[model samples]
Target: MQIKVSTKYLKTSSKKMQPIVSLIKGKKVEEAINQLKFLPKKGGRFLLKSLESGVANARHNFNLPSQDLIVKEVLIGEGPMLKRWTPKALGSATPFRKRTSHLTIILETKPGIEIKKEIVKKEKVEELPIVEEVKKETKVVKEEKLKKPEEPEISKRVFDVRRVASGRHKQNLDRLRRKEKGGIIGRIFRRKAGDK
Candidate 1:
């Protein structure tokens, strides 16, 4: 089984973090921690903490020995950029973007250790046949009755006219109405020409 952990929105750019994380890729957990401890970059410190967190998670949750664990993968991804403005000469401003990164580390057991497999057993269920009881019927004579007139028709479902008439349909309906009855501007121009 493999253990995975992630740290997001670290205050470091992917360009700066890639080189530091490459140093510990595929190394043993303890060795990686040791290498990160001596590094001068802040990204190394954060990465060390994230690796330790993964080790602790494996040890406490999975009962896996830390000695057999090795770093399998290191993934660094770009996160959201924060945009700001810096003052420039001649009454202008320049845009400044601060970059962020997300890091994920995967760890797995060393080679030659037999992995345990779990077997799932399904139980058989027996179904019994259902038997329904029959009832006896008696016959009787029927009498004729006069029928009344049918009532007015009513629909079973209703649709909203407002929803259908919204958006582009509404705009098209307005355009058609304006075309049928010339328009306010046309009437105004005609009245001015008649007066002239």
Candidate 2:
């Protein structure tokens, strides 16, 4: 399996990045990372970033091990150029082009070995015990509510329809409805209109 990663429009010249690309073009993933780690060049840092991104792509997306992967291709292409003008002698401005590089690294598995397939184990859900506990808790709560002193008939009738709703949901609905009764701006307009 082959995986490719590219970084575009890097703020470095293609010439500067090409040598680093060549240094690890055909090396194994591990060896390439080690080589780039110790290198003193700034280009090496960018190349290493792209290489590690490719390795992670292979491992997570393709289930390939880092040890079995090789740096199949390292292609450096010229990206967009930034144009500026530098003042030269005799009040004349010379055009300057700040070059950018697009670095692409391709990785593939070595031949004769199957890429390992990741096994996705479904989590074991023990629903019976949880359901049993919930039922017991509900029963206890219901008994406690029944043992409390009886409330006024009017208040019971008013709240009978909302008995099943949890308190948090009731509070949220109240907050939303209260906000809908015209916020600060609307209240200000209402005051001006004498419709308080």
Candidate 3:
């Protein structure tokens, strides 16, 4: 196993890279490369470059192919601070402390041993037991109804059946017909011209 570091001091770099570095440590070379390709961190890119260099070193110095590269460990540590000054209110100045980091990557290769071609075992696509997805009828999630002006009480009034049944909507017409007149009770549920 050989450990190598890209930067002696990362004093101005982001500390956010520690978690990602920890995630890839001890992972396979291929997986680490893929993860570092799109990871969204400033130090991650630099750390990836260093890790790749270590991997390359294993390949070239040890006379081994890429498949033999394995990340043994990764180390992250705090680096020297870069002091900065910022303008503050009331014509004063504020001293700002900028943080940096240092990263070390270690890799190892198996020696004097032959490794078979990596047979990528495909994850058995679990045949979902042919789940006959019962075609769910189209569903409409109902939203809240708008607040409308309250109708007059008209508690004692009785409504005529002939006035309500301007049947544009069949369901509304059937509902009005089923609700026969019961004096005040009937008037409370009367249909207007816009009911349909």
In Å, residue 44's CA in model 1 sits off its true spot by: 0.5
Error of 2 at 155 (Å): 36
Candidate 1 lDDT over residue span 63-158, tens digit each: 777788999999999999999999999999999999999999999989886555556699998897653432111111112223445898997553
lDDT (0 to 1) per candidate: 0.84, 0.86, 0.68
What's the TM for model 3? Answer: 0.52
Sorting all predicted structures by lDDT, with the top scorer first, yields 2, 1, 3
Q: Candidate 1: where is the Cα deviation over 4 Å? A: 114-196
- Cα lDDT tens digits, model 3, 1-196, are 4535455676445457667878787877888888888988777678778877776766655555657777788877788888999999999999988888877777766555553444568897766553334322222222223446699786754375444456434546566666664456655666775542
**RMSD to true structure for each model, in Å:** 11.7, 14.1, 20.1
By the lDDT metric, which is better: model 1 or model 2?
Answer: 2
Query: Model 2: which ten-residue window has the lowest total lDDT?
Result: 155-164
Cα TM-score per model = 0.57, 0.59, 0.52
The residue ranges of model 3 lying beyond 4 angstroms of the native Cα positions read: 11-14, 110-196
Point out the higher-scoring one by lDDT: 1 or 3. 1
Residue-level lDDT tens digits of model 2 in 8-104? 9888999998778888988899999999999999998888888889888888887777999999999999999999999999999999999998988
